[model samples]
Target: MTLTTDTPYALSAPPASLSEPLEGSLKVDIALVGAGFSGAIAALMLARRGVSVALIEAAEVGHGGSGRNHGQCIPVFGYLDEKTLPPEGFVLLRDSGRKVFKTIEELGIACEPVQKGWLNAAHDAAGLERARAAHAKYAGLGKAGAFLGPDEVEALSGVRGYLGGWVHRDGGHLNPLAYVRGLAGAAQAAGAALHVRTPLTAISRQGGRWLLKTPRGDISARAVGLTVNAYGDAAIPPRLRRSLVPMRSYAIASAPLKPDQRRAVLPGGVNFSDTRRDPMFFRVDESGRIITGGLVELRRGRLGGPTVAQAGRRLARLYPELEGLGFTHHWSGMVGISARQRPAIFEINEGLWALAGYSGRGVPTTMALGRALAATLVDRAEGARLWPHDAPGRIPAAALIGFGVQSLRGPLNKLRDRV
Candidate 1:
């Protein structure tokens, strides 16, 4: 058991690893590492196309950030066209991402999928104006989004502290784990072999084929896809690893609230995010429990781990109607983020490809990337339109700079609350 990358967060609770390494060298048309949405969807699509596929997971399916994190299925790409992205580039990203949400409905993978959309609430006048600016951009592109004022925001969200916001009509919410598992199950049903808990020790290409050395043994494949997002094990290039900085995010699910409390918080049950750089994003589950999350506490350090009662208390402060509601579950997990705040898809080598860096908008974005990568592999089809090619390049100082920026996020968030 030689060590590899020092990725924190062990398998919190395990049902046992479902994987055994390659006892004998086996060959396949494509090998996908990671059983999350991106890898699973691509594996399923390729296998269905009669391509031999092998799906590998370092841990159990959905054990990483995929299964963790808040289950908001909102479809807005996190990046904007301001200083970070060009106008044409944002149009491409926004339009393509819009199509990705459309595909989810077409696939019918059902995980309580909703398309009623969400709001990006403004905490101040300046934020409200920015929301309007975003609204204009989406409107120019003919996307079904617009600005809403304080009255409309209050009417919709039932929250007190909001100046206005933008509404994305096509965005929605879903169960993250269930959808990920569905993708994995689809791949298996389509004749792909899945190996879980078989951590890859190293990967190297030989004879135009990639060899994945795992704990149990080795497997060879003509092509490979790396879908492990934030939990960067050293199995990949340092450059690619630097593209995504892992950050710990926390969430708390309260015990089923009384009917009135539920009505008070999530009036119409539309998902919601805020203008805060590290905004508190939350929604009510079907079980009538409030699921809320935000930036990591300054005292909690960078690696978000087992949460404490303090998180629940903070949640209570935001929506005081639910004070003393008694939180049933509290936990945290890491999410992969790109400095450009957009996802990237690139060819790593001759036949090896990588698709990751969703910047915390992993739900719909993952589905979108999965379909595009699958199409790119199967027949050089056009699903590559899911993400624009000329998107912003990685910021050189992204790794260390991101850490420094996020380190101050907690305190800055506290300041925003006062504003």
Candidate 2:
């Protein structure tokens, strides 16, 4: 089966409906913006609890970053320092991967779920030291992580690396789009109404409820959850939009590798990303294709031909056995980032909530956050404390700041990798 699309997840995703957009006025207990992972998961969890939920999406389900990501279910925050996470945050992050798998199994989602370990390879001695410290810190917290020696790293990931790194056993990979679609199906089955191609243009308070004006209709919700992430600029409140800097990320999938070629690479079928500043991540798909991605320049919101070619070169360099392997798919998506480098979950109003800035850890992190958000809305005090309920402070000239950061990231990463 083909593995590439403008949104690749649709290729193998179980058949799902486009869902008619909302028309006229409707009222619900909760109206979720963005039918991506976060919103879909929240809808499913809340509906399962008998809450009336309406999930509105500008585009079809999984069309955003949910369908475009690398699909690794990392157990830790990508951009946050381990020391920065509180004890409770550490526990949440530690079990986030398992939570994702558990949810999938409970829902009986058909998405391929793999539980092989995740390899964080160290490119240099300094990287090795950081990895060692990370492993030790997690171990101190009674988390499941271990530092791999050079030999162990090589055995787990069939590539030449200077030093060893850490492995999170609970971490794994999945088809992100398929998973999101599965969640959407589950939410709908649980009595949640899903409206696709229905972008929210405004959110205003109406008496005791929030009125969400959509292109096709308006939804009056007792509680609203904005989970649009990078696409929230026009659809969400200005304060929340100003706090996020959207960054474009790119990925490519090579033609299925020969059996010998696959064995020469990720023989253990574990997902991997190196410790470089501009780290590259790769994992073998069920079809034996090597899927990899990293930071790349975007033209008109998409990766240009040159950037895709550069990704192929980078992949070949990482695994010499895959040199000259032609890529069968190239795609790009936007990820919302915060200056703080961690996700933000806070109240937009008294009852309206918003969550964003998973950085690049959306796979498992979003799942965990979604569940927490659902619980919070349901008045579950335990879930209310899953993440801090404080506003992510505004960044000055967020658009300009995002542009500057993206422009410098590639070059700076290259320089850091050399050091």
Candidate 3:
């Protein structure tokens, strides 16, 4: 099955050619399934350490969530209480965003990365309080964050209704597809073999190695890492599949804004998303057009038409100046949501690993997780310091609960917006 869907990023970026699909049996120290940011970054890291790595993808690189997200790269676990995070997880989340930026710079990946910062605007008094508390928590940890009152929020966002918000100075945005493609190139250059259009049909262990069977051939490796995220299929273990709920996320891109409109909206070119349960995020793209996205409910295995219309309406409400503006593109993709609403790292089998459930914070977090996983595979001592040794277990009926919550959240979010 074709995994890639037509999206603005796929049309704009130059096509990348990593390599042909696997045609015969190949042996490597590690075989990474999925060519999204996580798999590609892990491949690059491992290859740089002189490990034989084979990175395989079912479709073109970044064809999944990596290429279709809103592109905001902020710290993770934003909606969750800080006290619940494990010490190692806390450290990883705190440093992941910076690690992504540093890696991009050091690798010279031209992904149009912008470090202006991310603004978490508050839609109501309660939202403002939550933002303030989050800011205080980050501040207590020596992270640079600021609470912007109504006036400051309006000045920064050019939107009038926000009561207040918090700004994470270290957070930013980038062109995700370009970043993933660049990772593919970097990994291949570092001596890792990248096989595109190669889907793993099944995997089994034999003779202390993993045999990943593809349509054209098989790959033998000491270890396997699955980074397919929401696009995971029956090929993955049932435990991993049951641990995530895939939700459709919809986005729209407006025609390039006129000079006056650009000056009045997001003048500093910062990205912003509200603190709503089902939030809306907007950022000024490279072409000066407003790119916005929000959660949408799926019916009959597709995002309902009204859900897309609601997104456009939400955009207009936030920026009345751009009301009735022409949209250049509309697209949707699936994101993996965990039961606990946090990212999940699972060791599916003794030598097999997987990471998913970014919960809409995949950009920076995925790369960071990939690096940690690679470090662990390359050198246990070095990797253990960056990631926890305990792997996450399956969450019972997570998919059903997640879907039900999302289904209920849609109308409630619309009502909240009206209020």
Q: lDDT: which candidate is best? A: 2
State how far residue 118 of model 2 sits from its true place (Å).
1.0
Candidate 1 residue-wise lDDT at 185: 69
Report the Cα lDDT for residue 63, model 1: 76
Ranking by TM-score: 2, 3, 1
Task: Estimate every model's Cα lDDT from 0 to 1.
Answer: 0.68, 0.79, 0.78
User: TM-scores of all models?
Assistant: 0.82, 0.91, 0.90
lDDT tens digits, residues 160-251, model 3?
98888877777888888888888888999999999999988999999999999999999999988888988988888887787787777776
Q: Give per-candidate clash totals.
A: 0, 0, 0
Q: In candidate 3, which residue ranges exceed 4 Å CA deviation?
A: 1-5, 78-89, 298-308, 379-382, 390-392, 396-398, 416-419
Return the top candidate by TM-score: 2
User: Model 2: residues >4 Å from true position, as ranges?
Assistant: 1-5, 78-90, 298-304, 380-383
Worst 10 residues of 3 by lDDT: 299-308
In model 1, where do residues sit more than 4 Å from their true spots? 1-23, 78-110, 300-319, 378-402, 416-419
Better of 2 and 3 by TM-score: 2
lDDT (tens digit, per residue) of candidate 2 on 263-380: 8987777898888887877888877767777655434224446655676687778778877777678787888887677888778677888888888899988877888778777774
Candidate 1 per-residue C-alpha lDDT over 1-419 given as tens digits, one digit per residue, 9 for 90 to 100: 12112211122222332445456566888888888878887897888789999988988788777777677766565464545644544454555445545655655555555556688889877777777777776666566555677787777778777888877775666666656666676688779988887787899989888999888777898878788887768887565676776666666666677977877875756788777655667777666766666545555433223333554565566677766666556566677776556777767667777777877777767766776677666544354444443332455665565566556877786686676
List RMSD in Å for every model shown.
5.7, 2.8, 3.4
* Residue pairs with backbone overlap in model 2: none
